[model samples]
Target: MPGARSGGSGGDGSNSGSYSGDASGAVTVWEVVSLLGKLLGTVVALKVVLYLLRVCLAMAWKSGGASHSELIHNLRKNGIIKTDKVFEVMLATDRSHYAKCNPYMDSPQSIESLVFNSFS
Candidate 1:
C-alpha cells in the first residue's frame, strides 16, 4: 500500500491492477515487461556477437589450404611448427590419409573410433 498506486475502476467494467515494488520502488506492469524484454534482447545480442566473434577467430585460425604442405607452411608461418624437424614430420604425415573430414583445418580430427575390448 505504501508503494502501490491503485487505479480506479474503468468504464469498461475492468478494475485497474497494481504492480509490486521493484528495486527502483513502485513500478507499473508495462515497465516490468519492458525491462524484461530489454534484458532478454541484450542477452541475445551479446550471444550473437560472441558467436560471430568465435566464427571469425576460427576462420582466422584456419590455414585455408587444401594440401598438407600448405597447411604445414601456414603452421610454420604462424610459429606453431617451431623447428625444422617438427615441420618436416608434420609435412611428411598427410592429414587426409588419417582424417576423414576437414583435414586441412587447424583443429583436432577424429581419425578413428575407439573400440574397447574387454577380457572376461
Candidate 2:
C-alpha cells in the first residue's frame, strides 16, 4: 500500500462555453400568463364600460350645457360669439346643417336621464 493514490476521481468533462446562473430570477410562466390575462381583461372591461356609457349617454340628454355654456350658445345664436367651429364639427357629417347652428347641441342637447334607485 505504499504506492497508492488518494482522492482521485474522473474529472473528464465536455463543455467549453462561458456560464452563468439562469436569468429567470423570480417570475414564472404562470405569473407571465396571469399578467397578460389581467391586461387583456382590463382592456375588455374598459371597452365594455365605454360601450355601455356611450349607449347610455346616447339614450339620454344633457339638461345643462356640457362643454359649451348655455350663455355662450345664446351669444353664438345672437352672433355675438359666432359659432363657426361648432357648426363645422357638427355639420361634418350632417353636411346640410353646415351653415345652421344646432340649437340643441350648440346650447346643449336636451336629454332624459334614468336614475336607478338602490332602495332595498
Which candidate ranks first by TM-score, i.e. highest? 1
> What's each prediction's TM-score?
0.43, 0.31
Q: Considering summed lDDT, which 10 consecutive residues are worst modelled in model 1?
A: 111-120
lDDT value, residue 14 of candidate 2:
32
lDDT of 2 at 110: 29
Q: Compared to the true structure, candidate 2 yields what TM-score?
A: 0.31
| Count of steric clashes across candidates, in order | 0, 1
Cα misplacement distance, residue 87 of candidate 1 (Å): 0.4
For residues 29-70, could you state the per-residue lDDT of candidate 1 as single tens digits? 898999999999999999999999876754536664777888
Candidate 2 C-alpha lDDT tens digits along 37-103: 9999999999999999876654423332333355344444544444688745533443222213453
- Candidate 2 local accuracy as lDDT? 0.50
RMSD of 1: 10.7
